[model samples]
Target: MYQFPKGFLWGAATSAPQSEGAALKDGKSPTTWDKWFEMEPELFYDQVGPENTSNTYELYKEDVANMKAMNLNSFRTSIAWSRLLPDGKNLNPKAVAFYRDYFQELVDNGVEPIINLFHFDMPWWLMEKGGWEARESVDHFAYYASVAFEQFGDIVKKWATFNEPLVHIECGYYGDAHWPKVHDFKRAIQVGYHTLLAHAKAVAAFRESKYNDGQISIILNLSPVYPRSQEPADLEAAKWADHIYIRSFLDCAVKGDFADEFVALLKEADLAPVTEAGDREIFLNNTVDFVGCNYYQPMRVQAPEVAKRPISDPHDLFAPYDWPEKRINPHRGWEIYPRGIYDIAMRLKESYDNIPWYISENGMGVSEEERFENLDGIIEDDYRIEFIEDHLAELHRAIEAGSPCFGYHLWTFADCWSWLNAYKNRYGYYRVDIKDGFKRTPKQSSFWMADVIAKNGFSREQI
Candidate 1:
């Protein structure tokens, strides 16, 4: 049996925008997701918008109960910026009350709450002010972070400044997957610079505030990149891909500054972000207390087919290489490589001074899970159980090798609404019925998770 260390956290994670339904309720303002749905409803799956979600806003008490039932010792969820400060400047009384009650409920139920400040759900007002593009947005975000710490400092001990800030930089600016979709490389780099600066400012705020005792982190989706061949060109492509995708944010967060090589590349390509004085000092001083690594899959890459001397986009330096022997989750259109978890852990150990961290998010999202339901209205999601076991086995190997991994959290607790994808893919221990009053039902994996958490370990025979 592969056993976890004592007091290791076991739980799930979900963002406020993805789970909390009452979008405009309780004096809350509209977010980018809400505005996007209004402008382009067809972009979401089944035409479902942000308003039609799991209704956690009203049913969080029950949600906490479900989490406790599954033996989850911890839970990670974000606080919607728009909800707390509808105008992005002033606090809303109702929103503050609601969050206090919700977070307190998690603690009351013996579930440690790891609260994230931002998860790409910028208020519509912020977007109107150019969102992350405008340098002033960094100051606004720092004020917001101070407000969160001062308000919830007593209830929550662990905090995250941002979740997957790269997706906001890549999908929202460089691609068209998220809100304010545009295809501008210059704007993307500036947005990334502002985002990281905002993170540092928030960390500085936390350190200066009365809640300086609390731990702060940033959750990054770090995927280990693999080369398609042993050729030097392919190897170089993989290194560049890692620099662009993972190290850009990882190094800044952990080391408090960008790598010299990355800076030189950006300057050579004329893609460097405009920065002001004192920014370097802020980054150099304010580093995270720990890190949250969210690993889902590995990235396979090769040298770009048509390499440009001065790269215009990240794709110009590296190209995706499809592997012949790869298992894929056809439902989500993602490659499933459980070993990536170990690779990520070891990379953090060897490359980042063995910083303390945890698996903040990891899970399988399968579509049409109803097809696996048995007669008793229980979904026989044996595939989900096997997925967790396979990933945990690899995680155990890393832990045995002295990786400072303290916990593992699945992608979500209940199958909450996913942006763009909507409810098309179900990734929860308890099945959420969106059709019938958003009822919650435990799948087979819920029981399996309970058993694993109870023992704090499992073997292949348990499967």
Candidate 2:
């Protein structure tokens, strides 16, 4: 039998724009997502936009009831910055009342709320002011974080400054997946640097405020890098890949600065971003209280076929190699390597002083929902159950080996809406039917997860 520690947190996570509809209601302003959808509706799957999602703004009470029914003791969700500050400088009274009631409901249902400040939904006004690329945006973000602490600090004790900062840097500044897409490597570095600075400033503010004895951290999507073979060139490639993708943020968040080797490489390439006088001191003074890691898969890297050129784009530094023998998720086309999670946990234990971490987001997203529906009007989702079980077993091994992991939150609670994928891939314990007034029905995995929560762990015999 597998047994986790007492009071271990078991729950699910969701972002605001993906689940909460009513984009313009209750004095809410438009975010980058709202503007992006308006500009290019066809970019989204099925042409579904953020204007009408799961209507969580109107149905949060029902959603909290569903969380309690699932035996979840903790729930992680983000407050929309656009909803709270319509003008990006002033707080809306109606939005404050809404969150106060929403957070209180979770507490009333005996569910602990883990509040995150930013989750990729930047207010439109902030984007107009040059977004994260501009250094002043960092100060604005810190001020916004202070306002959130003062407003909701009494009820919420656990806070994450940003959810997946790397995702924003890579997708928005380097790739075309997110809004304000700019494909300049130098700009990407600048944006990433400012984001880390904002996180540190907010952490320093949190410590000074002493609000509810809270802990502040940043959630990172940390995937271990592996060399394609034992060759020295391939191994060297993996090191650079780790520096560019993982360590760029990990070192700053944990060690309070970038690695010297990486800094030298950046200097060599003439790709260093602009840094002010006291920024290093700020990062050094305000380290994270804990770390939130979101692991989904491992990255495989190999030596480039030819000599590398000067920095043209963010991905030009290293190349990703797909191993033919790796197991792939048929529905999502993503590599499924459960051992990667264990590697991440152990590495944290050994490398970064283990500083207390948790799996903030990990789950499977499958397309073609009708194939999984059963005659009982429920999604069988046995594949998803197996997927989660295999990962959890590895996590259990990590815990037994003394990794300071105290919680595991799945990618989401309900299959609401994706950014560009829309509802093409669903990753929720409860299936949401947008056609039927956004009705939610529990999938088989929901009941199975409820059992796992009740038992605190699962046995191989049970599976």
Best by TM-score: 1
> What would you estimate as the lDDT of candidate 2?
0.89
* Best candidate according to lDDT: 1
lDDT of each: 0.93, 0.89
* Cα-based lDDT at residue 87, candidate 1: 91
> What lDDT tens digits, residue by residue, belong to model 2 across residues 1-463?
8899999999889988888899988899999999999999999888999997988888889989999999999889999999888887889999899889999999999889999999999888989988999999889888888889999999999999999999988899878999888888888888988999999999987887749397888999999999999888888888888998888888899989889988887777787889999999999998888888898888998887764756555455557899999989888889999998899999888889987999999999999877879899999988888989999999999999999899999988888788899898889998889999889899998999999999998887765
Worst 10 residues of 1 by lDDT: 304-313
lDDT of 1 by residue, 243-327 (tens): 9899999999999988898899889999999999999999999999899989888999999988885888998889999998999
Prediction 1 global C-alpha lDDT: 0.93
